[model samples]
Target: MNLLLVEDDLDLGNGVRIALANQGMDVVWVRRLDDALRTLDGGTFDMVLLDLGLPDGDGLDLLFRLRRDRQILPVLVLSARDALNDRLRSLDDGADDYLVKPFALAELLSRVRALARRSYGFNDETIRMRGLALHEPTRGVIVDGEPVELSRCEFDLLALLLKRTGRVVTRRVMEEQVLPGGQANGSNSLEVHISNLRKKIGQGYIRTVRGIGYVIDVQSLARSTQK
Candidate 1:
């Protein structure tokens, strides 16, 4: 999962970022409301961990802007405002979930996972595609009941592809989400990774769409599994 964390406190932000990354989430942290807005405008994340207080402006203003623009991405407010009215106002203004400061990290991770499942419509943490299974929590992949060894990038790529099975995932989208910090790779690194992934999982499962992108053929996977 990819998450955008908007927080001004350096210590908290760094701690949360490390924790979330350890949980297999790609987290991008920004300290200011303007930076948060800019990150939102450019990147796609599974969820937003927003602090109600930001350096540039109130985080609620950013939330209001997102709602006004009809952005449906899940936003979970993380703030020190522990008033009943604060929580109510946040939900009313379009925040999906609210967590007060000095909370348990485990609880925060649970909430983030819940928001991710809700936003992505994932019924479970494990994704099954025919004989292939990608378990998000374990960071493990299995094919035909056998473990398949894959690098971190390969697993992330396969997980993304499985989530969007049968649809062509655009090159730009893949690069942004699968790459580190949405950085552009000048080399053919993506292709190299994809090629390695195909070699491990079987080339028939993934198909390149010529100039567009790549796709995981669910139907083809089903057919192959049945045979």
Candidate 2:
């Protein structure tokens, strides 16, 4: 998943980014609320990790603007304010969850997963498409009851494709979700990942749409498995 992390504390931000990246999430970190708002307006993210204490402005005001504009991206606030009013204010401003400073990384990850599940209307950690099952918590994939070993990037790419099965996921979208800040990796990098994934999942499962992008044929995958 693509996540925007708005935090002013350099050490904390770096730690959280590394932790989330290890968990197969692409995160873009910004220190100021203005930068966060700019990124939010210009880019696509599955969720936001916002810190209330920003150098430029309060995170709650940013949340308020997002809510006012009807931006439905899941937001989880992180703050040093552990008081009842502060927590309630953040929730009232449209934060999906709140975490006080000195929180555990595991707890933060759990809350993120829960919010994502609610947004996707899924109650379980495993996402099943056709005969391919992806276990988010464990970072495992099983195809046709057989475990499939994948590189980190390959797993992330496949997860994004499977999540939006049947839809033509543009290269830009895939890049954003698979790579942080949509960094300038060569164009062929994505293709290489797709090729590697195809070798593992079977050739016909993922279709390249020429200049457009790629799509996962979930129905065809099911039929092939049945046959």
Candidate 3:
């Protein structure tokens, strides 16, 4: 998932970014609310982690502005404020969830996954299509009752495809989700990841639409012929 983290503390931001990246999330850290707002205005993000004690302004004001502008992106407040009133205020101001500082990374990840699933209209962590299964929190993919090992990027690629199963995802669309900032990368990186993913899940799992992009047969790929 693509995430924007707005935290003023450099060390905390770096640590959280690294940890989330290790968990297969593309996280962009912005130290100030203005930078965060600018990034939000520029691109789409799956979620936002806003620290209330920002250097420039209160994070609640940013949250309020996002709501005022009718942005539906989920925001989770991460701050040291643990008082009941503070949590209530944050939620009332449009924060989806609140995490206190010195929090466990695992808990944060779990909450993030929950919010992500909620955003996708899924109440569960496991996503199933045909005979394929993906456990998002654990980053596990299983096909035909056997476990499949996938690299971080491969898993992310597969997750993106599965999320939109049955839809033809164009190269540009996939690149936007898979590549950070939608930046250009080494030639054929998408193709390489797709190729490797197909090898693990079987070639028939992802279909290449000539001169267009790829599609996953959400209902019947498991029964199709593999190249």
Q: Give the candidate number with the greatest TM-score.
A: 1
After superposing candidate 1, which stretches have Cα over 4 Å from the reference? 127-171, 175-227
Residue lDDT tens for model 3, 1-227: 77999999988889889989998888989999899889987765668999999888999988999899876678989999999999999999889999999898889989988886765444357877767888989999899899999998889888877765555567877788776566445568888888889889876578887776787764454434433
**Which structure is stronger by lDDT: 1 or 3?**
1
User: lDDT by residue for model 2 over 165-216, one digit each (tens)?
Assistant: 5555788888877865674456577877787888887755687777767877
Give the Cα error of residue 137 in candidate 1, in Å.
Answer: 9.4
Per-residue C-alpha lDDT of model 1 across residues 1-227, encoded as one tens digit per residue? 67899999999999999999998888999999999988987765667899988878999998999889876668999999999999999999999999999888899999987876665445457877768888888999888899999998899999888766655677788888787776555656778888899878874688887766787775664434311
Candidate that scores best on lDDT: 1
Off by over 4 Å in 3: 122-227
Compute the lDDT of residue 85 as modeled in candidate 3: 99
- Model 2: which residue pairs collide? none
lDDT (Cα, 0-100) at 203 in candidate 1: 49
Report RMSD (Å) for each prediction in the order shown.
6.9, 7.4, 7.9
